[model samples]
Target: MPHKVIFVLIDGLAWQVAHDCMGHLQGLCEAGRASLYRLNSALPSLSRPLYECLLTGVPPVDSGVVHNQITRLSTQTSLFHLARAARLTTAAASYHWISELYNRSPYLAVRDRFTDDPALPIQHGIFYHADSYPDDHLLLDGEYLRQRHDPDLLLIHSMNVDDAGHHAGYDSPQYRNAARRMDIFLSDHLPGWLDAGYQVIVTSDHGMNDDRSHGGILPEERQVPLFTLGSAFSHAPEVAVRQVELCGLAADLLGLSHDKPRNQELIRR
Candidate 1:
């Protein structure tokens, strides 16, 4: 059965913090409405690289998007490409990096802020350049895109958690509050999304550290939380999931073709 997918990527949310602070998501798991799993992020644990890794299932070394400074369109086929190839509509309310990766390169704010070209991989987009952009606003941006285009695949990427983690240490109150805030926002939207028959996958690109940095192998930086709310998933929380498997999982949920490996244990027969 094919279903619409809404992927919420909360940037810089550590496993511990997300498990502890995101009570709404935890409650969903407890109530048997969602499944939770711990995922080991891709190598180096950097944002840009992991973003590419999660979307393409290709490591940074192979994708040539090893560092954040690499400002060019991705060479590898991504989830967006797969969705578009399948003739599915796609939209993203995300950071500029996403636009640069799948749509265009060297993002020009005025021209690229809002895009609606059906010819592109991401057929619709509302991209943001500031890290401090509010999570609530970003979610609404995604909602707007959804209401307008009704895309089969919609991406909502929030940045406040990552910004808070950078401004304060990952252990700081601000960082925790950011995750909590996002959870509250999700609570407001998840119910509607579920009722509307949209399968949702919420996860992060990478985690942050107590030193206000990442790009390391520390548990705080390498481990992240994955929560799946959909009928296609098993309501079992103990699945061994990995960051790169997300692309295939989404593709599977949407009935799209993907060459990447997925965690079959996580899906219900």
Candidate 2:
């Protein structure tokens, strides 16, 4: 069994962005025999709902997190809760909304504190405010959490690149620069976990378009990249190959069973 599982959630990251900034990730894809799985987000194509889907293996309607705000859940099952039930130490550091959804005890969470929108929901956990473009300071926080806490599961959410791409357009230099910076983080900061024997899963909630506007029900907005690295998986399965279910991917990586009642055949190519 893999000692650690690290989920790296890059917000608003599209396949094109990864293709453009492929150097850092490319090596991992090659070295660890990584694979890319193209998966679609839920309808309306927002962050919160899709993230819920990724974590719980349930859709927005089932998870009761259709939008960015917190809603009453009929079944309040989360990946963190499940991990804890299995006696696994879990931690997450995300932008704002996600941290709120999974902010429970023993779960190290860091909420982003750069938002001005009051209507936006509040997230609990280990919150960290980003002061500038490249919040490289997160590296230190991530290291601290991994070394000191040594959580069995650690999730890192980077929004600087996503915010830049949304505002300045995905094709702009700002987005490219943000991607490069993210690459640096992965190349420089993440390998420590690998050295310590962690299974790293890098993915996105959904992809963005050149205009940077999502929620349009388009493939670019719905389809995102899913890459897995470490000793758990041997090969980076081929692209244009069979499509893997997003929720199933998460469940498989964590050694959990699929909890939803959907047509699992739909995702199989």
Each candidate's lDDT (Cα)?
0.92, 0.62
Worst 10 residues of 2 by lDDT: 115-124
Q: Which one wins on TM-score?
A: 1
Candidate 1: clashing residue pairs, number: 0
lDDT of 2 by residue, 35-110 (tens): 5556666665677777777776677776666776553332456666666666667665565456556553222333
| lDDT of each residue in 174-252, candidate 1, tens digit only | 9999999999999999998999899999999889998899998999998999999988787665678878889988988
Where model 2 places Cα greater than 4 Å from the true spot, the runs are: 70-75, 104-125, 129-135, 239-248, 256-269
Q: Residue 237 of model 2: what lDDT? A: 48
lDDT of 1 at 122: 94
TM-score of each: 0.98, 0.79
- Residue pairs with colliding backbones in model 2 are 33-235, 33-236, 34-236, 35-236, 109-126, 110-126, 111-127
Off by over 4 Å in 1: none
